[model samples]
Target: MPIFVVERRFADQLEASAERLDGINRINADEGVRWLFSFLSADKRKTYCLYEAPSPEAIRRAAQRADLPADVVTEVSGRLMPDGSPVPIR
Candidate 1:
């Protein structure tokens, strides 16, 4: 699987109820995309989400189905360690 960092921007404060979240997860699963987690900006108008999927296109499709923004989809190889070294994310 490939890991991706998705940047989404909203016109207003971002909000999603638990039921809406469950629906989004179901939609993601249908597209073979796993929602790892997300970080919210201080204003809560933006989110940086991590995901695992077969390809960037799969992620895009999932986003489209969920009617969510996938403003930037970047593939990441691994994590950066404090010892000035790179480590595999898995």
Candidate 2:
């Protein structure tokens, strides 16, 4: 699977209520899109979600099913760390 970054912008402040978040999780699982995590802006108007999917289209489909906005979907590949060094897995 390829990793994708999905960006969503809201007209007003956004808050992921428990019910909404749960629905998102359910949709992700049902659509076969792995929702690794997400980062919401401090102002709560924007959200950046990281997901692993077969393709960008898969992500879009999942967003549609979830009834969430998919402003931009970008494919990305990289390592996660403070530096560029790889950390040993236990």
Candidate 3:
């Protein structure tokens, strides 16, 4: 599976309310895409979601099904630590 970074920008404040999060989780159940994690900007205007899927198109489909914004989907090749060291995969 390839990892993808999905970016989304909100017009105003980005709210990650429990209900909205639940909705996303629900939509992901059968989308063939796994939601690894997400980062919400401090200003609450943007969100970056990390996902594992067969292709970027899968990620877009998941977002569309979840009714969430999918501004950009980029394929990522690696993950690293805050210290700039590569994180070992088990």
Compare the candidates by lDDT and give the number of the best one. 1
The whole-model C-alpha lDDT of candidate 3 against the native structure comes to 0.83
Give the residue spans of candidate 1 off by over 4 A: none
Show the colliding residue pairs in model 1.
Answer: none
lDDT to native, each model:
0.95, 0.85, 0.83
- Per-residue lDDT tens digits for candidate 1, residues 35-59, read 9999999999999999999999999
TM-scores for candidates 1 onward, in order: 0.96, 0.81, 0.80
Angstrom error of the Cα, residue 57, model 1: value is 0.7
Candidate 2 Cα outliers beyond 4 Å, as residue runs: 80-90
Instruction: Order candidates by TM-score, high to low.
Output: 1, 2, 3
Give me candidate 1's TM-score against the actual structure. 0.96
Q: 4-87, model 3: which lDDT tens digit per residue?
A: 889999889876789988878777767888889989899988989888888877778888888778999998877798999986
Model 1 CA lDDT for position 67: 92
Sorted on lDDT, highest at the top, how do the candidates line up? 1, 2, 3
- By summed lDDT, which 10 consecutive residues of candidate 1 come out lowest? 81-90
Cα deviation of 43, candidate 3, in Å = 1.3
lDDT of 2 by residue, 1-90 (tens): 788889999888886689998898888888889998889999999999889888888888888998789999998876568877865321
